[model samples]
Target: MLVLFVLAFGLFAILNPRVFLNPINLQNMMVASPEVGILAIAMALAMLTGGIDLSLVAIANLSAITVSTMFTAIASSDPATAESLGGFIALIGVLVGALAGAVNGFLIATVGITPILATLATMQIFNGIAIVWTGGKTLYGAPAVLSSVGQATVGGIPILFLEFLVVAVLIGVLISRTPFGRRTQLQGANPTAAMYSGIRSTSVLYGTYVTTGLLGGIAGLVFLSRNPTASADYGTSYVLLVIVIAVLGGTNPTGGFATITGVVLATLVLQVVQSGFTAIRLSAYEYAIAQGVILIAVMVFDQVRVRRRPRRAPSSQTETIALAEIPRA
Candidate 1:
C-alpha cells in the first residue's frame, strides 16, 4: 500500500507538476480526503470481521440530515448562541450515527442476519427515513462556527485533515493495543476457535458494526463541515468507492486481518489519483474505470502472493500421521 501510494503520488506529480503539486491543490486534497477516508476506515472495520456495512453511507447522510434539520429549526440569529448550539448539534449528529450503528448491530448480532444483507436492507430503510424527514429535498444551513471549524487551518494543515489523522491513529491503536481488537481479529480468523476461547462472537460483531456506524456518523459531520448541506442522496457513489479503498488497503474480505496504516495510505492513493484525473481533465467515468482496474489488480496480486507463500507444517508427528491417514477426497 505504501509503495502504491508513493507511485501514484509520483506519477501524478510528474503528469501535472504545476497543478497537482500546487500548495492549494494539495490542501484541497487534504480537505476532500476526510469524508471518504473516514468512510473507508468504517468499511475497513467491517471487512475485518468478515462482513460489510452497505448502510454506512446511508447512516452518514441520515446523521448529516438530522444535524442540518436541527440547525435550521433551532438556529439562533445570535452568532454566539448559534455557534454553541451548533457544537451541541454536531455532537448530536455523532450520536445519531452511533444510534444508527446500533440498529445495524442489532440486526446482525441479535437477529442473526448476515452483515451484508442486513446492512443492505437497512441502507434502504435509513435512506427512506431521511427522505421522509426532509421531503426529498436538501436541507441547508449549519452553524457558522461549524463551517469555520471545517475550513480552519493550523500551521497550514487543514483541521479537518488533522481530525481524520487523529481518528485513524486512535482506531489503529484500538486495533493493535486493545483486547477487543484482539478478539475481533480472532473471531474473524476463526469463529469456532474464538468461541472455544470464550470470545463471544455476537458481542464482538455487534461492537464492530456499532463502531463502524459511529465512524460513518463522524464522516457525515465532516461532510457537513465541508459542505453544510444534507440530503438523503448525498455521496451516493461513495458506497462502492469506500469498499474499494478497504480492499485495496489489504483488508481481507474473508476476515482475520486489517491494517489502519494500509487503509490511510490507500485513501491517499485514491485521493491522488482522483486529483490527477481532474488535473488531466479526465471524465468521472474514466476515473471509475481506473478504480475498477486498480481493485482487480490488487486482488490478483494478493492472490498470487498468498499462493507463493509457504504453508505451515503440522507441529506434531501424530497430527501429521492423522492427516496422512485421512481418506482422500
Candidate 2:
C-alpha cells in the first residue's frame, strides 16, 4: 500500500511539479495530516480490540473546548495563572479525554453494553455536552505558547507532524512489541480462549478504550492549537474518515489484526491525495466521495476474500470406516 501511495504521489508530483512538489504545499499537507492521522491511529487501536470508537472526535472536541474555556476563564481573572496554565493545557486536555474514555469503558466493560452501541450513545452525549457548553459558538484566543506548536516549525518540519511521529512510534511499539499488545490481540481474536487462559479481558478492553481516548484528546488539542479555536462541531466528518483509514491500513474490522506502519503510511497516502486534489483545484466534496468509494470497495473486497477461502468438511463415512478397519487390523 505504501508503495502504491508513493507511485501515485510521484505521478502527481511529476504532472504538476510547481504545485504538488512545492515546499510550501508539502508543509501544508503535513500540517493538515496530523489530526486525522492521530485519530486514525486511535481508531486502529479500538478496531484491534474488536471494537470501534465512534466518539473519538467528540471526545477531542469536548476536551479542547473544555480546556479552551478553562484557559479563557483563568486569563480573564489572573494573567499570571493563565500564563502558567497555558503550558499545562495539553495535559489537561488529555486528562479530559481519558475521563471520557473511562465512561465508555465502564459502559461497555462493566455494564455489558455492546461496544458499537455504547460508543454510539456516548458520541451523541459528548457532542451534546460540547454544544451546550460552547452554546454553539467558537472559542478563540488560546495562549501564544500553545499556538506555537501548530505554527512553528523545526528544521522546516511542522511540529504537529513531529508530535504525530512520536505518537505513532510509541503506539506501534505498544501494539507490536509489548506483552499488553499480545494480550489485546488474543482477546480480540478469541475472547473465549483468552478468558480461559486467565487473561483479564475486561481490563484489556478498558485499557484499549482509555488509550484511544487519550489519543483523541491529544489530537483535539493539536487541532485547537492549529486553528487556535474551539468549536463544538469541529471535524464532524472525521469519525468515518478515521474508520476508513484504519481499515485501509489493515486493521481488521472483525478484530485481531493491525499494523501501525500500515496506518501511518495510509495516512500519508490520504494526505498526499488530498493535497494533489487541491493542487488541481478539485472540489472538496470530490475528496469525500472518493474516500467513501474506496472504503466501500475495500470492505467488499475483504468480504469476498473471506468468503472465497476453502472450507473443511466433516469426516465422511468411507474415511471413518477405513480408519476403523485399520485400527482393528
Candidate 3:
C-alpha cells in the first residue's frame, strides 16, 4: 500500500511535468544500494543473533580507508611498490573483516560485554584508527581495475548488485539451511536451554558477530569503489538505515531470526521510500523524521501482534479443576 502511494504520486508528478524514471537517476539509486544494502544485511544478521552492530558504519569507513590507501600505495609508479596489488589488498581486507567479526563475537559471547556497549566502543576505536592512519588525508588515484567493480555491468545490471546477490545467497544458506542457524534460533529462544542442549551457544553467538564484520568489510570496499575516494567519514548515514532495513524486513530485535527474501523486499521498500523523500523535496531532517515514524509504527504493530497471539491450550491444572466441578454430570 505504501509502495503504491509512492508510485502513484511519482506517476502523477511525471505526467504533470517531471520525468520520474530517468535512467541516470535510477542508475544512481542502484549505485547507492550496495553500500546501504550490504550494511543492512550485516545488521540483519546481528539482529538475528539477538544483538546489534552499532559499529557497522565505522567498520565500513575503516575498511574503506585501509583498502584505498593500500590500493594507492601499491598502484604507485615506484618499482619497489607492490605490483598488481589490487586483488591482493582487497582479499586481505576481506579476511580482516572476518577477523573483526570474530572480535565482535568474542566480546559479546566470551567477555560478557553487551553488544551495544561493545560495538559502540569499537565503533569509535575503528573510526579513530582510520582517521589516524591517514592523518586526516584522503586517498586518491585508485587503480582502474579496482574501480571497475563499481562501474562495470553484466547484462545491464550493476556488478555491485550482483555481488550483493552472491553475499545474500551465502547468508541465506547460513541462516536457513545450516545447523549453526538452527542453534542460533535456539540461542535466541532461550540461552539456558540452548546451552543445556550442548549446542555450543557461544560459538553460534561469535559466528554472528564475525559474519557481521565480514559483511561490513565487503560493504566498505564496495563503497570505496563507487566513490573511488577514501575518507574517514564514509557510511555514517547507513547506521540507522541498516537497522531500519532489518526491522522493516521482520527481523526480531528481541531474538536473532530473519529471512533473506524478507530483507530484500524491505530493501526495495526503503529505496523507494527514500527516493520518494527526494522526489517530494523533503529536507534531510524531514527524511529522518519519516524513517523514525515508519520504524516506530511497524515495531509497535509487531508488539501488538505478539501480545494478542494466543498461546497453546490453557494449563492442565485449569482443565482438571473445571472437570472436577462438573463431575456430577
Rate residue 14 of model 3 by lDDT: 71
* Total clashing pairs in model 1: 0
TM-score against native, each model:
0.93, 0.90, 0.86
lDDT of candidate model 3 versus the reference = 0.77
The C-alpha stretches of model 2 lying farther than 4 A from their native spots are 296-329
Runs in model 3 lying further than 4 Å from the true structure: 1-18, 78-83, 304-329
Local accuracy of candidate 3 as per-residue lDDT tens digits, 191-273: 78888999887788888888888898888788777977877776678888888888888788877578776676667666666
Ranking of candidates on TM-score, top first: 1, 2, 3
Predicted candidate 2 versus true structure: per-residue lDDT over 1-329, tens digit per residue:
57758876997898789999999999998899999999999999999989999999999999889778888988898977887878797688889999999999999889989999999999999999999998999998676777888988999999999999999999999998998999999988988999999999889999999999999999888888788899989999898889989988889888898998888888888888788888888888998887777667667887899999988776798688878788552
Better of 2 and 3 by TM-score: 2
TM-score of 2: 0.90
The candidate maximizing TM-score is 1
Model 1 segments more than 4 A misplaced: 76-80, 312-329
Prediction 1 global C-alpha lDDT: 0.90
Error of 2 at 262 (Å): 0.6
Candidate 3, residue 203: how far the Cα is off, in Å: 1.2
Kindly list the per-residue Cα lDDT of model 1 for residues 1-329, writing each as its tens digit: 78888898899899889999999999999999999999999999998888999999999999999888888777645556666788788889989999989998899889999999999999999999999999999889887767897899999999999999999999999888999999999988898999999999889988998899899989999888999999999999999999999889988888999998888988998998899999989999999998998889888998899999999976798798899999997
In model 1, the clashing pairs are none
